[model samples]
Target: MPNKTLRVERVTKRYGALTAVNQLTLTIRAGEVFALLGPNGAGKTTTLEMIEGLRQPDEGRVWWGDVDLAQKPAYARQRFGVQLQNSEFFELLTVRETLELFHSLYRQRLAVPDLIVRLDLAEKQHARVGSLSGGQRQRLALACALVNDPEIVFLDEPSAGLDPQARQNLWAVIRQLQAEGRTVVLTTHYMEEAAALADRVAIVDHGTILDEGTVDELIHRHTPSAVLELSREVGRDVASALSSVQRVDIQADALLLVTDQLEKTLIELVNWANDHQRPLTGLKTRQATLEDVFLTLTGRSLRE
Candidate 1:
């Protein structure tokens, strides 16, 4: 396959009074693992569908290199592999049979036996799809997507509803896909999955692109501070008086102090606690993370 860049240029989608996706623009590099991350109705899937040729955008254009994807959807389809959130197969069919059925849909495809082995499905080759575990079913979905062997692979919430071990196993497969130089576009609510697999990430919320960059870049750009968690709530005035503290937020049961100077903040906090004869119970310091960046941008957790 020729090296190609996928571009979503000022795209917008609407359903009645609701705008599912706003005027969003993004560029995905070839052979890079890119993740669209947000809450359930953040338009991540809508944007993915537009780029995958599964859905049409109300406005704007999607381009694969210089070719317009909206104008040449059939050609785009030939080069894109899509695995939706729920991929249904004939439950009675064996894993190998399921793969064979999907493989027949395209002229260009991978060998079934080899694909099964690559996806770690060799052990369940003869097992009926109905009898497979959640993880096995997910692997089968991935295998079917790969049967086409397209240049770009689109996965929507690939690890949802999976156990810890199963999620880890699926993550390894995604990493392998990146290693093989396939451009991968995945939408997920799992923060760790995005942090672990994506070369770059776009944080989407309320039908708009909130931010986009490497994990570290996003965290640094949005929240370049350490978080100090206090056992009890601290008044705004008290927290603001601390050295290097940028802000203070009160959670349900704890106080979150954002500071750039961790050492000075700790020393001040300890001194304040000692002077007040109050225990600094459950105090901890941690560097800002992707979750922090998301919360800073949206004021809500990704699972919300």
Candidate 2:
């Protein structure tokens, strides 16, 4: 199969007065795993739907290679595999049977047994769809999407309800897809998942694209500094007076101090606490992360 480049050009989708996706433009390279990272209602799903040709954009173009998806959805569908956020199957049907049913719908398809084995579902191949666990069900969803042997795969929150081990297993499957030279576009609210699996990520919020880059690039661009976290609350005025502190953010139970000069800030913070007679509980220092970048751009946690 040929790897396909997918592009979303200035896409906008509105629901009455509320814009679900606003002038979002993104280019997903072939054979790479691109993740859309955002909180709930952040237009991640809407953007994916528009690109998948499930919903038409109010104003924009979605192109899969030379084909405009909005104008020729059937052609796009034939080339792209989609796994919706909430995938439901015939409960009575066995895993192999479900794969067979979907395989029949596609002109080009992968062998059912190979697909099952790739997804580590050999033992559960004969199990009823409804009888599988949450992770098993998720694997089955992915298996169905791959049954068509698509060039591009779109997965929306594929590991949403899975446990840690299951999530890792799902990530492995995603990596295998990338290894097989398939273009993968996924939407996720899990920061660690994005950090671990995505080659590049687009951070979206309130229907707009905040930033797009690799995990390290985003952290460097948005949070090019170390963070000093303290459990004790620090007043904004006091925090602002600290030397070398660029910004101070107050969380529920901690004070996050962002600084470019880590040494200077640490010394100043220590002296300030000593002078003020306030104990710095749970003091810790760490490098910036994708989660930090997300909070920096959106002013909210991914789970929020």
In candidate 2, which residue pairs get closer than 3 Å at backbone N, Cα or C atoms, i.e. clash?
none
- Minimum summed lDDT over a 10-residue window in model 1 is located at 231-240
Error of 1 at 298 (Å): 1.8
Q: Which stretches of candidate 2 lie over 4 Å from their true place?
A: none
Candidate 1 per-residue C-alpha lDDT over 1-304 given as tens digits, one digit per residue, 9 for 90 to 100: 5689998999999999999999999999999999999999999999998888888899999999999987888897777888888888999999999999989988888999999998899999999999998888989999988898888999999999999898888889888887888999999988999999999999999999999999999999988679888866456678878868887766567677888889999999889988998778778899988877887888766665
lDDT of 1: 0.89
- TM-scores of the candidates are 0.93, 0.96
After TM-score superposition, the amount by which residue 85's alpha carbon in candidate 2 deviates from its true location, in angstroms, is 0.3
* Residue 213's lDDT in candidate 1: 99
